[model samples]
Target: MRRHILPPVTRPILLLFALAALAGCGPTAEPAKAAADEHGAAVDEFERGPHRGRLLRSGDFSVEVSIFEEGVPPEFHVYAYRKDKPVNPRELTLTMELTRLDGRVDRFSFAPQGEFLRGAGEVREPHSFDVKVRALEGGRAHQWAYAAYEGRTTITSEAARAGGVTVETAGSIVMAELVDMAGRIEITPEGQADVRAWYPGRVMALNAELGQTVRKGQVLARVESSHSLQTYSIPAPLSGVVIAKNSNVGDVAGGEALFVIADPTKLHAEFFVYPRDAERVRAGQRVEVRTLSGDNRVVAPVEAIVPTADIASQTLMAHVHLPPGASATFRPGMGVEGSFQVAAWPTALAVRTKALQRFRDFTVVFARVGNTYEVRMLELGRQTPEWTEVLGGLEPGTQYVTDGAFLIRADIEKSGASHDH
Candidate 1:
């Protein structure tokens, strides 16, 4: 159903337009012919009533079809006249049907309202459809059929693919408030271990070397006690890769660590928060962490916020834990980027942000039904890079063009189609 007020929008016009904007864009259908009458003759007359509505005639019975959409959803107002004389709305029975591209039919029956007949249902958007009207008056039957289109274009399957046209369904989404910050990957102090000999002595044999992976309690080195002249085995304190080795074979191990082991998997990303974002950023908020090259990404909550500012940059820091399995790709000291979710809002109706485009004075998206794509004007609310809240002008479950929408708009403009009564 119609959601907001719009101007005269439905007009049957050119269908076939150039796909010249892209290379190898396949064949398109030919331009459509004019709307035909009940006798199958091309209707070529252009008649407008005093209300600026379309005028159709069958003998002495004529009806003016107009849409009233000032401050409400679109509704049809039919003014009946017999030989230029106003006919009481009660004297006629009128019904209209609109067949849309997707094979859905909308029927509206007219009832007496003031001096004219008002439709029982709303006239929805895009307004591109085949219209049929039947009127009964004074024991006579009158029929008129025509095509009305606005913001519509047709394309074949191959053309759509070659033009990079993509479609996605519109639905509910949660809008996030993001704060971008520069960051780096690091290993926490708990991830590192220092191995030391129990007694001051000369290292007789070194079992573990730098850059070697070792298990907890694994023999790291053997040392001889200088005090008692007894030999002892030095073991690794934690299971990790040996990052540092000080005392080696034949070297004196006197009050010094011999090996340093660090768990590469225990990592966190530190993001620098500026003064402006200090109030909004806090621990426990969700953060989107990505590598410098943007090839890898992960979502995790902020592990904690450093209470003190960096001595060099004077910026606050937010730490987000990296997945344990991510150590193979993300490493210590590697530069990264993190987007902190400072706030969020949930919405029931939303569309892809990438699908939105400018149409006239409105922001619109191309809605798809079979091979036809038409513009859907939107009233917007909160917006993010991913989705935007749809305040009006769209229905749930509608498929919309998310990519190559520019191609559709270009064709409609090149074919000279516009909002027309």
Candidate 2:
């Protein structure tokens, strides 16, 4: 009975004390909770200065950009701004680009730069954006967005370009190549029936006309001399079409050709070369001839190049041998072009004809630097339809555009870029 009576006062006092302690704890936590809620809240505010990046001339041929943040992470976000213009989603290629910069390099890629190179084109951008900086080291991250001044952030890269012809090269170069040449059939200088007339002084008559067909030893006309009254008919020297006939029946005959018939079976090409090219010319050299008729390219071997040059033309004549029974399409006096292999250069650096751009005295090419194109001046030597021998100005292992050189030039010109081409 005594314990029960004393516990009553203590129990009531303990309950009151507990209630007061709980009330104090509730208010104390309110300030801390309010601070935490405000700490991570989204804010609407503005900042001054160039907190964003704007890409300028991307080196000589492309565009690159950098933000004002030190120790930027590998996975930083990039925002593009274009003075309120919407961005082009198709042109963006961050996923396809090949990253080459080492970890130490501040440069980073955000688009698929390689796919654009599949065609002949180029890319130029002006936009502003916001991005998140993903920390790769410890997974720490931060986010930011910039309005980017009226014109901020630009990226330039190379794209595939279409090919175009160089008009100036047409007239300066041989319009076409000639591969074969042959002489017309020949006959006696006079219309003589005599089986044998070896002397230079012989008068002859003729009955054949230009383009007339004649047979070997067939009497075409008669030959008469002042000493004798024997009239002999001039026979066809060989079976061929008469290409040229200088005399007709009853005409006074001189040692000059009365009828020139070429042996169709025996054909050869004769080309004239300048004195400089004649030095490199030799008998038995391989040559390619392009006939003016129907783009004919005939390959033949050089037979002879006379040591003498034509006094009037100042040209060295070279005879080229052809295959027997050639197509009749090739005729005498047809213009043809020829090519000769001068020498070989082992390990010679070369590129396709389309890869070159002709300047005043030098040649230029677009050299790939990273994802951009750089103008490279090249020293050129011998050239062919398919390739050009590079004497200098390009590396052996580098890749270059072969088919779309003109498109690249067009892009550079359109952009008002400084280039040698």
Candidate 3:
């Protein structure tokens, strides 16, 4: 029995080993490695493919791009021709398309020209035109549209890509906005208020502290007639608060104020204006007064503009009327500082104060188009304390930097930080 059991167990074990060995020798493959290799080939082909662009239509004018190698800007320059005569100045339009990775396409167009090119010479002169572009992030097809002025008629057309460019530099590039240039005026006063003894009276009943409200004709203190010749009651002429008391109870009549009363509503400010600005400081111009005490800004109308200027100071004094609402809370001696709305260009373009930048030579501002920032040259006009008048280079509806403008300027000054306009 032991011999038969041993043979059966040994034979079964031998058969199992033989089957496993045969299975191990069967077919096997590196599937993952093969897949990876195929993906690499696909990527290479995508990167090496050609990008094609064509000028679908062009005005009698043409533009050449030289600054940016491929994706960079400062690229397009335009030239005009009249007939075949090379008109001293020609008007033009164009269209262009960009084809990017993954078969994506982009298109762009140019704004109409308002002015003819000055001093146009024959033989294709060099000029730059700023066109609006739509980005095709990763595609091969894009379209451009432009307009050309050829005397009577305008020409519109599309341009295609001549080549594709790849950038080797690696880093981050972002477009940022910048502040406009501005001017500010700071002044120190040289005039003082005149203080005099108001009246000499007898002490009456006391009714107020240093800052207490007293109505006009209100009896602050009553005095029994010390002089029989003057047997009339004395009353306050102005409604104000008592600031000082010279005499106490039961004192003899002295020629001093028993209670000092001042009218807070009668506050006045004298602002000096240059002779050039004097013409604008008429009797009815609007004025704005600003004080550092909270947000207590006062807007008032000009009451009068004194024609005579202080000869020594070479400045004219302009007196503005404050509103009763403002005068109620204001004190006479409180200092007020701000600008006068002398001459207003009602149709002028303006931006907020915080939008300006103080540059060494000329003021600079960034014009925002979609997500891109464009450098702008500005000619500034008369400026109010809160807003600056834009003389040139910017459109009215454009959004500009109001706060954190310096940060935008810093970003722009950095190399490769701004997009070409």
Candidate 2 C-alpha lDDT tens digits along 94-121: 2212121111112234542331212112
Q: Estimate, for each residue in 193-308, the C-alpha lDDT of model 3 and write its tens digit.
A: 11122334445455556667777766555555654434335566667666666666667555556666665555555567776665555776666675534356676666666788
TM-score of each: 0.80, 0.42, 0.47
Stretches of model 1 off by over 4 angstroms after superposition: 1-52, 68-93, 102-122, 254-256
Q: Pairing residues by index, what is the TM-score of model 3?
A: 0.47
Instruction: State, as a TM-score between 0 and 1, how close model 1 is to the true structure.
Output: 0.80
| Candidate with better lDDT, 1 vs 3 | 1
Task: For candidate 2, give the lDDT.
Answer: 0.43
Task: Looking at model 1, report the run of 10 residues with the lowest lDDT sum.
Answer: 17-26
Displacement of the residue 208 alpha carbon in candidate 3, Å: 4.5
Of the pair 1 and 2, which is ahead by lDDT? 1
- Find the 10 residues in a row with the least total lDDT in model 2: 10-19
How many residue pairs clash in each candidate at the backbone level?
0, 43, 48
Compared with the true structure, all predictions reach lDDT values of 0.79, 0.43, 0.39
TM-score of 2: 0.42
Q: Name the lDDT value of residue 150 in candidate 3.
A: 9
